[model samples]
Target: MKRIYNTLFIVGFISLFMSSCNDWLDVRPSDEIKEEYLFETGNGYRTALNGIYRKLATFDLYGSNLSWGLIDGWGLVYNLDKAPDDGGGRAMKKIATFSFKHSELTPTTDAMWDAAWNIIANCNNLAQQVENEDTLLFYDRTHERDMIFAEAIALRAYMHFDLLRIYAPSLLMNPGERTFIPYVDKYPSYLSDRQTVSYCLQHIIDDLKKAQSILLSVDKSASFSMESRFIQSYNGESRFLGYRGYRMNYYAVTAELARVYLYAQKADEAYAEAKKVIDVVESKKWFAASTSSSGFNKGNMKMMEDIIFSLYSTDLTDWDQKINHLSDNPADEYNEHYLCLGDELVNEFFGSEKSSDWRLIYQLEGKYYDYYYRTLKYNKQKEGTTYSKVNDEMIPMIRMSEVYYIAAEAIYKTDPALAQKYLSSVKKGRGIKNVDYSQVTSEEEFINMIVSDARREFVGEGQTFFMYKRLKKNLLGMEGYSWKEVEAKEENMVLPLPDSESNI
Candidate 1:
């Protein structure tokens, strides 16, 4: 909590706000802020918002933990026993087993909550300030002002939805009244618990919708431009107009709304919104170059061409190879750097079409790593190599393919044919010749297909846990717990609120 205040007062917050527009989104300042004049100019507001995005990309936030570290480990994407002794190793194993109360897991979980809430508090501060800002102070005379405000709102909802997904129970599992976490709306919000699952979810959806409405006119990223990946002078519009893929623009907001509706079990609305994204993206012919593992081995490993929203960092190349993908397997299994699957899990994961899956062909071959079989999803462009500037150092938060999956999942029960078409399209994109849908006669089988595809499609992306949690399904256990049945605890989807929040 004190961290949040320290941020608002200064401690790099003010420095980031005062940074030149050219480097606003690039470098985070070491020194802090001058709170009194933080919002005096339009650049101040822009820098303030950029500061929040930078925070979101920190190692404690999406840069590692929430993206592919803690959440993915919990999703059982990696073999729990293979968890390394350092770099969140014990915490990863405990979280995988739902040992939320264990001392090993406390620091990680508490940091997750604190880091997320700190970003949310900063969002609240920006929202509070921007509402009263003079539109004329902005470069585009309300366009930039409105864009920042809308982005702030959408980002707030995005983080809130994530917090709700992590900390609270879903309506599907618990229909009865139950307490939920606080919906901190304003700056310096007194975190309290008076909300319900229904109340918090509705507010999140409402906030997204409000953001979408405002961004409708301000945003031009219906089909995102590749140039949006970089910050350049578009007649002094680079700060706001550029970087749509990283920031929360109109389509990202719409995509997020579809995700929320699906979570709330409103399949029809979810399908409608998802279809909107799919149609626009396809019509625009965006990501047409995305084929054969969607830019694997070509430096677009993160699938940037089709990514709807992502987070960027300059530090990705430093720790990615050594930490996630080690050159050789450790002598002690428990001493491994990160979790990875063995031949057995790999065979089961790929099933009969092992040769067809491009992920196996490109991402996991021994050529990439001399000994260990690891997914090279996060490796970025470095000192050499002729990959495009947009190829590396990006982590996808959501992408067009997932939107297709959402559409397929949402409408499967009512319209299986359309659903299969949607699902098959994605499979086809992954280089599969033909998908046999005859065996998926039942809705359960369809969902199983979805789960299998998601597990395969998002190997190191950390989406598997949320998919499991949303559907209230069991997590696939590893090592001591067999895939079939080693124990009888239902899926540990609910990450308990930290003592700091709970005890308060």
Candidate 2:
């Protein structure tokens, strides 16, 4: 496993420099060029940064397991029993059933741990080089240099937070409890000690603050807003320096800070951060809610209009092929493998008088599995082609809708009317009529409404599990197999650290 880890790291890092010649740092390397040469120029830093994103688009990380395949399946949003009894299906069953100790899960768990840390390792390497005086000398534009560093810091924090989300107990459950997962900033040595969850979260928050500060400094506009500069910087010729929604820009960092605060249960702070993002994004017209019926349809790479941050990957077809189990021929249904949506999800989201919700339109009737619904969310096939021809597939990582949810939840205790307004914005965007706050009887009911909306809004995006874990709520689907049942048998809310770390 260690050997595999090292091999993956080396390949990923090398590919960072070799993969792209345009937009990315485009220097050709000499036969004897050392690793140090790669960071001696601004282009080198840019290439290195792009490399991190490329690695993120691979099968192990956001491209698959972290998004629709493993994590969302674990959320019990899908009918895991319908999955074939292959290695992938067995792993999904272990995750869904909360059978954390099954030996079959070792490979999946180990891959997640290694891939996250591997990205962190690359982050540390980039930070170390970028901070050097010699590297600073190569910066033709200091703003570009600062922007690169800011993104690196933010990306590092994001990866650490995700690692904690996967490997440590939820803050709501364990508060300041120590976890086996170490908050690694520097490249890891075997001697690293585990940090408390509180310590890790604080570290993540601090890094995001640094990123926010750096981004603000780069903005020379009268408003001194990084978001404004990010918009202005996107002239066609200067695309390299322009901050796209796909990149970790100022608003993305702010959105992430709100998420971290919500996880920490800092309601006031979370509300403030979320509201700040909402105001800036709306005022600037950075994104709009998707009201089109074909918003999530196949062949469309951009899923919505209100995406705050996403990953542009040519490898989206790989993800598409993995989940495209539906066929034109009914005969293929028995042999094909797919993740089926749970009846609970279908009924809760689509079984309402407000059936006009655009999200509901993506559900296709399953010919193979009776009474099952298969999602076209991952289906990227074109009109005539068997698969998507689109290379630049945008996989949404964050969006404006999440901010509204966070704001609504954070302020629900003090300002029910305001919270309901925030929640109503999401519903209004989805074509549902304005929600009457008077109809909501209690705080718990309002919270459930927000959770339910989130379940529908982010069905295949791999956010539902994190929502369940954070709120410590029971899974609404699967009779007798809710999170409450799993919580009873589990010592902690998270999967155990892999043997590699446990042995250490």
Candidate 3:
């Protein structure tokens, strides 16, 4: 089932708390905090930041829609072209036909698109306020302003990069020829058709570069010290409100930059950026996933070691009540939607030992069909309290592990040998003991292999469709039997601007 956009009211309520007293829904920040003020100080800035994080966790955006619902549920169920017309089902169904109009998608999908830009709007608003900051609360406005500005730019860059991936063509195939959805840098002014895929890619790169510049300006000591002082001084409730999770931290911003560069095919540059985090990225403890939750709870966003960028919430139990019921059974709490891999692709990957592969094994009775093995990485728990839920499971927008894969693939186009080194790093970690070094004979083969691994590893995590689009691979049957015949078109490359935004 597709996730509905019914919870937009909650988002609006959150927005109300984040806004200035003069204008609750408005994007602009004000100088003073009134009942309506959204950005009067560092705390208000934090609230605005929390607002963006909230959007990331919302049902319409990453929380359910972009993550499990759209990517896993819709894509998988529609593998044979069987898309439900439920509240969130349209995009997945329409994608295969290359027939989704701007008007056809659910408000949920529309809100995700809008929410990303809305984040950009917030970042812009904050960036302007921080640049001209005059709030009496800060002892040193310049230093604080610089850090906040960097985070804002990084957040904007992150949001824009995400928008481009879903709404643009592959960067490798005539990137200069394809159009992307509207690239809103300043506040969105008018609805525009797609730009050349290259244009969109370039736009992302430029924004990221700006983010890197602003982010680089921040003093590392100051990063930890500012929040530390706030925590030390404030009481519990005050501290909780003060530390509301928002704003791109240093690692999150850098991790996303590595990913953007990798997609742009700047392998060496991507590696250089990723290398900066090698220590942080490679630490086994950091990358180790938490396993405390059950069923759908398993996929809940918890603070894992390697989560460079993710959304968070203190209300997971409530979230569980709302989205958890959709899971078929207690132990079978994985994504209902997925890219139904055609028999051929599954056969190719599984070989004769298909049943031995963990991903191909069916654990639950009802989850599998004759040809399919439902993914278990996101399994929900079988038992829990009425309000039982998991934390540390947020929508993973970026992660350090992605840096490994992106670095591997990006380098394939440049240094094939070096690319293999990076590929082995991940493959070895996944327990694929001693992969044949000779298997990656050429760039194409290497890319194909790595991407295939990516699909399997990141299954139900919302990375596949963008990847297929980025590689310009034939949509049909790229991975499996039923999908072997799909071909995405120009219109398919970039979804039309949503009518809601266009009409506005």
Candidate 4:
């Protein structure tokens, strides 16, 4: 990944120098060296492909949203936090209200929309450019192009999937009535209309399916590190560019597709997609964590064993932004008062069986001291820091444990015993006692038990809000809010489109 970044820096310098030259007459036609022209060669195509990874690393794109906002932002949908009304936290509050207007969302949301589409546009360009070329022109061109296409297709699908979750209504099982986001198969000459929510999701699924097909053909040996991938200055300042973790490979793509499918509620497809990860985990070859002091940062053991895909920070410092984004937390980064849901809901989820859950208890300090239990998993270190500026954890995008939960869920739909087997697999991985599902008699009882297990397995991992959205239920105190303000509708199951994109 660092090699790719170095190559991109060189490309950027050449482009800058060429642009600065006033005497284009001394050289061949200046346009001959442009992106369009340069990409005509095999190496140029490779560069363009790598450029996709680079683009995803930008702050306005995946670097911020995919791992941060997409996870944290959707946490709002489930009332995970009480988003503050002042400053940066305001937009997230607006999302809770379903009142987002295009003029009100931040530039970040707008930039993210454009960045996502830029990837799609570039991928489309590549697909068009490579169609007529023969396999014999370059080194493993056929294999490379296929892998590139796979990556791009997954990326495009991911972007659209993000949009659908944020904008469209919940997807009903019926294909004919499902809502979707805009679909852009070919680049438009002018603005095009949005597709139905269902259409958009289907297209995303289609793209992912295509990605999975070609990904199966790619080489899998890729290594990554902070030194080479990050743009570090001699004095230690760094521009956070390059692959977030190691370069994304085939396994990551498949895992991501499984997530997309799960959200779409395509149980059968979700199962099949998740099975790919199950196979990997069973082999003990993928998703292991590293054994460093800051293991949560680079060289994470958890990342090696169970993380299917993640974006790495250019440096450990980047975690500061995530920890304190939109808020103020000085010890680490920034902090904010994004409203977490009231205690009633938090406790209800934990239940009276407190002994059975550890995450709910980990925050005993915050709960007993402040009356509100802040997330302990993301707390800042006590090293002379303020309440703001304190992001200091690696946000995981996909974890292998999710695969176990997914398989468990899928298995429950057909065979209870089998579902119990998958659930036990996850428990064993967590070093917990193996649970036997034979003890569960009723279907509803079995589901509730499985969901409880999932809650234990994925606490603060960013899957709660999605489950809330899918179940279409309100947070525990939603009724109280509705009574207190009469008009305070609980928009718990959906996320509004960023007003900026809606207006566009």
For every model in order, what is the number of clashing pairs? 5, 0, 42, 59
List where candidate 3 sits over 4 angstroms from the true fold: 1-36, 71-87, 102-108, 139-144, 175-182, 187-200, 214-247, 282-303, 313-366, 376-392, 413-415, 476-483, 499-504
Could you say which candidate leads in TM-score?
1
Q: After superposition, how far is residue 419 of candidate 1 from its true place, in Å?
A: 0.7
lDDT of 4 by residue, 318-427 (tens): 43234434564546321344334345545555555444343454422233223344444434444433211222334455666777677777768687777777767655
TM-score per model over all chains: 0.88, 0.85, 0.73, 0.69
Best by lDDT: 1
Local accuracy by lDDT, each model: 0.70, 0.67, 0.53, 0.51
1 or 4, greater by lDDT: 1
Could you list the CA RMSD of all candidates, in the order they appear?
4.5, 5.1, 6.8, 8.1
Enumerate residue pairs that collide in model 1. 10-33, 11-32, 12-31, 12-32, 14-33
For candidate 1, write residues 247-319 as lDDT tens digits.
Answer: 8878888889998998888888888989987887678765333556534544655556667788776665544
List pairs with backbone clashes in candidate 2.
Answer: none
Winner on TM-score (1 vs 3): 1
lDDT of 2: 0.67
Can you write out model 3's per-residue Cα lDDT over 112-170, one digit (the tens) per residue? 77566666666666666666776454434555566666676777777777777766555
Off by over 4 Å in 2: 1-33, 85-87, 132-140, 188-190, 219-237, 294-302, 326-328, 331-336, 363-370, 381-392, 436-438, 479-492
